[model samples]
Structure formats: structure tokens, C-alpha cells
Target: MTKLEQIERSIAALCPKELKAFAKWFEAFQADLWDMQIEADGQGRQT
Candidate 1:
């Protein structure tokens, strides 16, 4: 199976509490990525 499929299966196996924690972590992870992209865009525009 693909790595993504493995990740999906592993996430599906998480218990309720673990899933909640993972969701929170994932949200923060996404937010950080977004912030970094915005910063990079701003820097590019300054050139």
C-alpha cells in the first residue's frame, strides 16, 4: 500500500482521545505551514 494509505489506516485506528489530540496537533501543523508560506510570499515580493 501507499504511504498515504498507511497513514489513513493508522489514523483510523486511533482511540477517541488520541484522535482529538491528533486533530489539534494537525491543525497547529497546518497553521504553521500557512504562516511560513505567507512569510515566504512577503519576502519574495520585497525583491
Candidate 2:
């Protein structure tokens, strides 16, 4: 199976606590990605 499919299966098996932690981490990761996008935009780079 592909890596993305593997991750999807793993996520489906997470317990409540684990899912909460994963969601929190994903939120921070997305925020960091957005920050980088904004920084790139400020530098006039096409995202």
C-alpha cells in the first residue's frame, strides 16, 4: 500500500487521546505551513 494509505489506516485506529494529540499536532503543523506561505508572499514569491 502507499504511504498515504498507511497513514490513513493508522489514523483510523487512534484512540481518543491519541487522536486528540494528533489533531493538535496537525493544527500546529498547518499553522507553521501557513506562516511559511505568508512569509513567502511577503517576499513576493508566488506560492
Candidate 3:
């Protein structure tokens, strides 16, 4: 499994009930970081 999937599986096995919250936060964090990276790339290309 991918690292992310492995982590999720581990967490799920340990705390099934909290998986939803973990997923939500993980998605938000990944999306925000991706947006930042894209924005940075745009800035870099413009410079």
C-alpha cells in the first residue's frame, strides 16, 4: 500500500471511529499544500 493508505489503515485498525475526522483533515491539508505549491510555481515562472 501507498504510505498514505498504510497510515490510514493503521489508524483505522487502531481507532476506527476517528478515521472520518482524520480523512477530512488529511484531505484539507493535502489540498491546501497543493494549492500553495501551484501558486508558488506560478510565481516562479513569472519571475
Candidate 4:
């Protein structure tokens, strides 16, 4: 399985309470990473 799939499976095994918190944190972290990539790439553009 892919790395992400593996992580998902592991998260699914967690207790519901922990899983809910983890899901929210993971989503926010991923959004931050995506935003960082967009900003960095924009800075590197040839003009």
C-alpha cells in the first residue's frame, strides 16, 4: 500500500476521540503545507 494509505489505516485504528482530533490536525497541517508550496513556487517564478 502507499505511504498515505498506510497512515490512513493506522489512524483508522485509533480510538474515535483521538481519531477525530488527529483528523482535524492532519487536515490543517496539510492545508498549511499546500499553501507553503504555492507561496514558495510563486516566489521562484521567472519574470
Candidate 5:
């Protein structure tokens, strides 16, 4: 299976507390990714 699929499976088994923590972490991770993409765009880097 793909790495993403494997991660999905792992996430599916998280306890409520773990899930909440993961959710928080994911939000920050996505935000950072978007910030980097925007900075790259501003610098004229091809995505």
C-alpha cells in the first residue's frame, strides 16, 4: 500500500486523546506547508 494509505490506517486506530493531538499537529503542519508554498511562489520558484 502507499505511504499515505498506511498513515491513514495508523491514524484510524488512534485513541481519542491521540486523535486530538494528531489533529492539532496536522493543522499546524498544513499551515506551515501553505506558508512555504506561498513563499516559494513569491520567490518565483516553480511548484
Candidate 6:
């Protein structure tokens, strides 16, 4: 199967507690990505 499918299956296997922890981690990961993109955009505008 594809890599994304593999990840989906793995995530599906997580227990309730593990899933909650994963969700929290994923939320922070997404926020970090957004912050990086915003910083890059600001730098580009300055140049």
C-alpha cells in the first residue's frame, strides 16, 4: 500500500489515549508549519 495509507492504518490502530496524544502532537505540528510559512512570507516581502 501507499505511504499515506500505511500511516492511516497505523493511526487507526492507536488506542483512545494514544489517539488523543497523537491529535495534540499533530495540532502543534500544523501550527509550527503555519508559523514557518508566515515567517518565510514576511522575509520574502522584505527583500
Model 3 per-residue lDDT at 25 = 89
What does candidate 1's lDDT look like per residue over 1-47, in tens digits? 99999999999999999999999999999999888888988888521
Task: Give each model a TM-score.
Answer: 0.92, 0.92, 0.61, 0.66, 0.85, 0.92
TM-score (C-alpha, index-matched) for candidate 5: 0.85
Candidates arranged by TM-score, highest first: 1, 2, 6, 5, 4, 3
lDDT of each: 0.93, 0.98, 0.81, 0.89, 0.96, 0.93
Report the Cα RMSD per candidate.
2.9, 1.0, 4.0, 3.5, 1.1, 2.9
**lDDT comparing candidate 1 with the true structure:** 0.93
Give the per-residue Cα lDDT of candidate 4 at 32: 95
Residue lDDT tens for model 2, 1-47: 99999999999999999999999999999999999999999999967
State candidate 1's TM-score. Answer: 0.92
Model 4 per-residue lDDT tens digits across residues 1-47: 99999998898799999999998998999999888888888999532
lDDT of 2 at 10: 100
Which of candidates 5 and 6 reaches a greater TM-score? 6
Residue ranges of candidate 4 with Cα displaced over 4 Å: 1-10, 45-47
Q: Which candidate's lDDT is highest? A: 2
**What TM value does model 2 have?**
0.92
Q: List pairs with backbone clashes in candidate 6.
A: none
**How would you encode candidate 5's per-residue C-alpha lDDT over 1-47 as one tens digit per residue?**
99999999999999999999999999999999999999999999956
